[model samples]
Target: MRQPGRQTRRPERRIPQSAAELARVHERALAEAAARSAARDSAAPDDPPFLQPRPEIGDSWERLRRLGLDPDAGAAAVHLGPAEIEHRRRASGLDPLLPILRGTLVEQGEQPPLILAIADADGHILWQEGERGLRRSADRIGFFTGARWVEERVGTNGIAAALRAQRPMQVHSAEHYLRSHHSWTCVAAPVHDPGTGRLIGAINLSGPAHSVRPYLLQLTATAAKLAETELRARRLESLHHLRTLAAPMLARVNGPALVVDAAGWTAAAAGLPPPARLRLPAEGWGSTAVHWLPSLGECAIEPLADGWLVRPVRPQDAVPAVPGGSDGPGADTAGPGAGLLAEQAEGARLRLDLHRAGSPELSVRGAAGSWSHALSPRHAELLLLLATERNGLSAAQLADALFGDPARTVTVRAELSRLRRYLGGLLAHRPYRFAESVLVTVAGPEDPYDLLPTSSAPAVRRLRAGLVGGTVRLPGTPPLPGPRPRPGRLPLPPP
Candidate 1:
């Protein structure tokens, strides 16, 4: 669309000399962009390079436009109740680190004191502390504790944007999609679970637009890192306690065995190579039951003081013997060949219960006996795709399927590798899939829209769309059904 020899000017890449001036520039640029967008006109060809919004800001603005959000609408007023807020605070993993965050961000008492808020992954502000005057101002805009700030609810802002992007983010002045938030500047960084890399919440700093500082983004990011470090350290301490308790228990075991914390981190091992972690049953290991562990095969799991003692069942032997020689809590007494005979009669079967979004379950029945493993959201997605395809999915194919980016094969491979640890021989590599000998079935919600409600993957979105339109059906499985109750826990065989 440009004449020959004329090229679009690129925005400057150098750091701005003054934060206040940069905020002013962004405000002007946003005003012009908003005007052009509202008028349905392309950006003026002769606009100055400084008039262009940053790429992320521009993208957010476009998304808001597509969603038909009103730039002039007052800030969203919905907030979680007090009871819900308290529950989230306790579960956010941030409560214990509140003192650290307050020390790092609040007690420093910078001039023009800033407001610090911590929000859960869902963007509900779980805690807020700062200058009294600033807190009062924030309260007017529904930015206090218990308020939801996700982009979908309140338009573009740092806390919601950072959580959505899973990274550090800054919003200054009119860069906010909602005009109601245009007077403020904020920086936020997402905090993730140290063990599972799941997003837990975000650390946010906000103040008047005039208070915008180049260092605030880094400060927030540093606070988030510190919180994660503390969380990891706490987990390590727990593992240490578990190791101390497990040492004596595993010493008395007869064969290959290990002890692991609830999150599956190995604390100790005997007669085997200790994997750093093991995938345990989703609902957690029952104190008196034998479970099928992918890495260890059939395992008799005994509850230790702070961990579990896992002993592998030998194929030649009917049961894994307990330390006391009595068929006790950690003993498998299914009798010789009981599991093998069941496998021979029924073969291997995999049932994916995906009717519930956040609680996906995978049940595997075979020579090792039947057990259900709770699935992470990502794992559930991978299994759904594999179950539907039947022919399997290469890393590249799966990368494209999940992320809409084929170049993300490395991420796909890493996740698949973790899954293989939980699946063992039941899963095959090359093009990843369930082994040919396994029969896979998927149970889904009757309302197609309910399928993986939390997933934003392109493939899943498309499948949901097709299903709602009656153009698609859950392939390689029986017809979708209404919400079904989860099966009761399998009764442990009598001791």
Candidate 2:
């Protein structure tokens, strides 16, 4: 109440922080970050490269809080405005999973660290996944579901701590500077997409300090993997729809060039008819340098100075050879030429698609038409970069481009096993196996490294075309049929 002409002033909000609180926060940050760095180094040592920190983590957060920063309020004070909360929610991709994950925290199963709050990748709590009261209080203190939690913004918690460590972690009581969170222990692990291996989110278990042990970090890590795997399955199913429409335009392809060496044969030119070269029916015309497309049978094999090209021999001015279909100009069914064209187009498109698919997540194709791929997004990216380069990338080159830490080469190699499995599963097919490929290393073709998607499409096509087209020799005895109807008009007038 204003007394006459005097106005009342609102009390300023003071952060509750003891000296111990400050030290605990700083120590946890340095120690955890160092541990993660060491783990990364030990996991990758052959590469002698190094990296540096940005906007240094030291004192990044406490300094901001001390400055009374609240961008939404447009005032230098603590305020969790609606706009700010929404902003954080969107940035984190958290709104989709918040309710379900939060429900799990509250449900009567094995109670984990009560997730009082949860933030997205950017450290913003898109939704609180814990006790309502704790959630409300935390929200008031600016720890709602949708709010940033970068190390510099907020020090030491399941969210920031996990991101800082780049590993699963538990930041126990006293480790958090804000008095509001001192009663909690938060365990967090990053969640990634199995397909791309990108960090999508983090699942955190927050509860009373006594309930969560540091070793529980292992459990969170496993759970995070499961979550990621499930997401991968869903993503694959969705992407499959995009990849495999009902049209028979494409089929699962995998492997390297199927080679048939013609070292024993003589050479010829493309247009020039070599008197020594004999024309083989639809297929027999082929060379080691280049083979006839299996689909076009009995084609003339003409070898050019650069390579060999096979042209099909369709009978000149011949009628459509397709059975049980109209042979008119507007025939809608797949005629001989059309069938051959479809195959040609498919072959062309397959090469382009495989080449453009960017990342060869899986190198091997299996019989089942699926293949395995990398579990680490970083590795997948490295594989793509290596495949794209004129020369295959070395371990050091990959590490430097990916993490700016040349030491990550070992992790990259270790991760390839998982990538191989992923790739193998995705590209499963018979005759198109995805083992390590023997490609010409751009640096030195003889010094082959195995990160590329080596495909033997030509060889596979040869076998497939023969199997699909050659085996249609119907063996049953032929029976005479009833009188055929008149062309275009019925025989009613004659009857």
Candidate 3:
């Protein structure tokens, strides 16, 4: 409360009028923050109510310190060879967008020159171009093609920070963890695959610290967005091409049929409502052959230039004849569909070989013969959850069980779709589970704790910790009467 005769004075915020002044202010604040961090026992200490490093920069500094990185390290070494760099450039999805990035950030020829660098998801610089003097400066710091700029290698920098945060970021002067980079300023943004939402690479605009401006962040971000837009347009164009080619082929099919691209985007459909996409098997359409599909029973697949044509077999064409003569005891008494129904009831046999630590395989034996596929760590975790819960699990439930976050339903669905492509009709949806007729059997390691050794999913972790209540016994092994003991800590039979 102010006295009637006097007025209270509030501190006024002072805004820097030029980039140099701003840099000076940032340097002072960073010095104080760095001093505090150095004197503290913890990598991350509470910031006082004063000018300090931004949250992202502070977090990165903390991470670098925790990783035991030397702040005075020299220029980062280029670890990627020329051949490997070329391969990455072609596969990065950024190579084609170089022209757009150059036009937006490089070709501008602004007063204070800057360099443009593109790094793949792994933080290896694939391309860099800019004003001649600026390029030389960048080269002096090993900011050339094939140089790895990830935090683990070069300490905190724009490309590494943007990729780590999965967003646009700017690192200026002392904000960089390495003292060698203190004279440089960089602004970067991560680019993602529009179709799959996977980070492909990052675009960065960098120059001497004095050239840094607030607008550089937006400039880099705009360049990254343009690259994503181009990628999305190209995807749409490919889908259109597939659609045009599929029209006549789908028209000639008599029964339910559809055509889909390699990524499972539907191009055309006949005799059925077109699904936005179908989950194709992991092996994909290796050759034109008959394959069992979860959504369409049995389908004959024909390979196209860029996609596949799938036609479901009609019921009359799919049914097999009874083995015995019609005069046999039950043959004559049964209807024409009895044998098919019996076969359907018997279903398929599924065997999960998870006893080994690193090699997990799923084997299925049915009317189509036997085949097996190696399971990725994530797939193995999902299968384990489904096998344990015989009644099945909803998308949300599975998401919660796997990630400890029920809101990650989309991630759960995507993974399950890939799993279904290979499993075919053996797996079922609408609360994902093995088909009722599938004879599901699991073979875990002799030690329950050794199950899915590489899995970190919440469900797997809980099961390994003996937090899940159940009698999990391997085939021919006696069931433990009570809760299972954690592996490595106690002697226990495999579940």
What overall lDDT goes with each candidate model? 0.67, 0.38, 0.66
Clashing pairs in 1: 282-374
Q: Backbone clashes in each candidate structure, one number apiece?
A: 1, 55, 1
User: Cα RMSD (Å) between model 1 and the true structure?
Assistant: 12.5
List, residue by residue over 20-48, the lDDT tens digit for candidate 1.
45455546645654565432144376755
Candidate 3, residues 1-495, lDDT tens digits: the string is 111101112211122134444344445544545575532233245643234455456555544554667777734476789899999999987889988988888777544688888999889999988888878878877788889998777887999877755667777777777777878888888787664445688999888887667778877887877898898789889989999988887778788888888755677888875555454543445655887654455678888868888887843344342333232111111111212332442567878888875457776667644445455556777888888776789999899887779999998897676565455566778989888888888888765545764444566655654522353454324576886544312222111
TM-score of each: 0.64, 0.38, 0.55
Question: By TM-score, who's the top model here?
Answer: 1
Q: Which stretches of candidate 2 lie over 4 Å from their true place?
A: 1-104, 110-113, 177-181, 210-216, 250-495
Q: lDDT tens digits, residues 289-372, model 2?
A: 332222222344444332233344532322222233322211112212212222222212111012221122222212211112
Candidate 1 runs further than 4 Å off = 1-91, 107-113, 121-123, 148-179, 182-187, 196-199, 208-219, 249-257, 286-288, 311-348, 351-363, 371-388, 392-395, 399-418, 424-470, 473-495
Candidate 2 least-lDDT 10 residues = 1-10
Model 3, stretches more than 4 Å misplaced? 1-55, 74-76, 109-111, 279-301, 313-495
> For model 1, what is the C-alpha lDDT against the true structure?
0.67
Model 3, residue 43: distance off in Å is 15
Query: Per TM-score, what order, best first?
Result: 1, 3, 2
**TM-score-better candidate, 1 vs 3:** 1
